[model samples]
Target: MKASLLSAAILATAIVSVTACKKDKSTPNYAKADDFMASHAIKEQSFSGNAAAGFTITGKDGTKVTFSPNAFVDGNGNVVSGNVTVTLKEVLSKKDVLFSGVMTESNGQLLESGGEILVKAQKDGADLRINPALQNDGARVEIPKAMNKKDMGLFVQDKRQQGGATGGNQPQQSPYTWNPAPYYPFGNGPNSYSFSLPSFTWVNCDRFYSDPNPKTTITALPAFQDNNQVTDLQVMLVFKNITTVITLPYDFTVQKFQSYQNSLPIGLQADLIIIGKDSDGYIQFGTQPITISANMHIDAPIHKATQAEVDAFLATI
Candidate 1:
């Protein structure tokens, strides 16, 4: 009888010890990590995560991203702190993309739960909003608030076109299409006096010279695309169901709200149409316009393009 009792006691103690260890140990929340990887366009096929080891993933562009063992939290939101590393072997092997950051346990919980809330509410995917400054140091974007990824995708494509990527790819198909000049954002007519608002000078091409000028044609020129240079003859802002026509010399400015009788929200998007004769004498050009939000306070940088520059661009197009 004593031997049986001793065995029972040992078994009970062993059970208690095992339970304690289980309580003390925690594993990574694989689901949350997987969601993060997918949202960033990173491939999660090779993902490996656990309490005893680290987390890792490969991006679509063949970049490798890894988190230290404790970089993630468990099911209950407790952070597991470990070393974090990022490798861009195929993306930027020669360039350095190293980053470091610190996240308190509370912060991790907030971020994790925030993402969950967004995915549920949006039905569509969400974009983790990290502070722009954090993006500078190679730190992965700090997932704060989530943005509607579809809307943001449109926004980024517009930005690329405005930055002279017009010839790189066809304009993305969207219900609302507005094209800003590949050279400049704002238009300033000859001798404008509104110094507070800025205007960008752009080259307007004339593929079909009319009147006294002779039309010049390049026999060896490549096929025409939307990238041809054009001047800003007129621009109009369409938003809040109101169309505000801006003639020669207009400021894509914060004051645009006044046109709506102050009915426009601060961050609301406005579609723009720029009608001007291209170098070929064809009236063709339109683009989406960005908002004059807080980020664009005072004035945004001006982009200028010349007629010669426009011709040079056409040659390549």
Candidate 2:
């Protein structure tokens, strides 16, 4: 716990302010950490095609998506035929996952994710759905394969578990889990991982995190000297040796960040990261290295940082 907490403390210190900061519409001085994250998020790739003929588009990141002919249907179940638009948001790396933030856990079990993608379609100013009967398998998606693991299976993200903030865009900070999917990916060699569309919202390649060490909970406290300056706060755990990342949910009752009970492997080495948007719209960050231990309460630091510095740290991940 101390190991992860220390890292969080370090990240809390990298606070940066800029006119470019994003503020929530509801509040004048308040900005959400999620909004900050989304501001620097990876750009979405868009494509256009007629629903009757279908189309395919490849993202700069090498994510390939195909829309089969008559693949989409209206809310009334009528086959859509006019020009349709599609957007793809691909998260292929650990840093990408942090920004897109499709969390890695299901039923309290940690997951190791390879990649994730959110695909959506629009027709004539309205949303559309995949026609499962005609295009369940016809809607093919291929994500660039970075690391291939035979255990890496398909999973779907559930927004219902997001603890309410499911309306706008994907919540940057949610404790949702990824449900294991029966669908499998082909082309597991080197180029990419290919699979048919299972369900749209969010999909990824993931497997349960395995370890022989005992598991325990870790606690992190990002005690900013001027608590009033902080608005949106986020605590994160980055596994050093494994391809896994976790967003520690804040415990309002205790006024600190905490991990899932018995979710972390004892002796596991991880870096704790804390990020918050100050009331003035400045972004703060800190990081520290820690090794898991029993009954730990890690403390963090408070310092200023620049947007360049923050981007540098994210690039290292």
TM-score of each: 0.18, 0.80
Off by over 4 Å in 1: 1-48, 74-317
lDDT of each residue in 132-243, candidate 2, tens digit only = 6874455898887773344477888874454432232222345456877775544464667778886568888888889999888777888675565776667888778777
lDDT of each: 0.26, 0.73
- Stretches off by above 4 angstroms in model 2 are 1-39, 147-151, 159-175, 183-187, 225-228
Q: What is the TM-score of candidate 2?
A: 0.80
Candidate with best lDDT = 2
TM-score of 1: 0.18
| lDDT tens digits, residue span 191-298, model 1 | 210011011111111011012222111001112245656543443333322212221123234222112121223554444433344554444433344553432322
Worst 10 residues of 1 by lDDT: 114-123
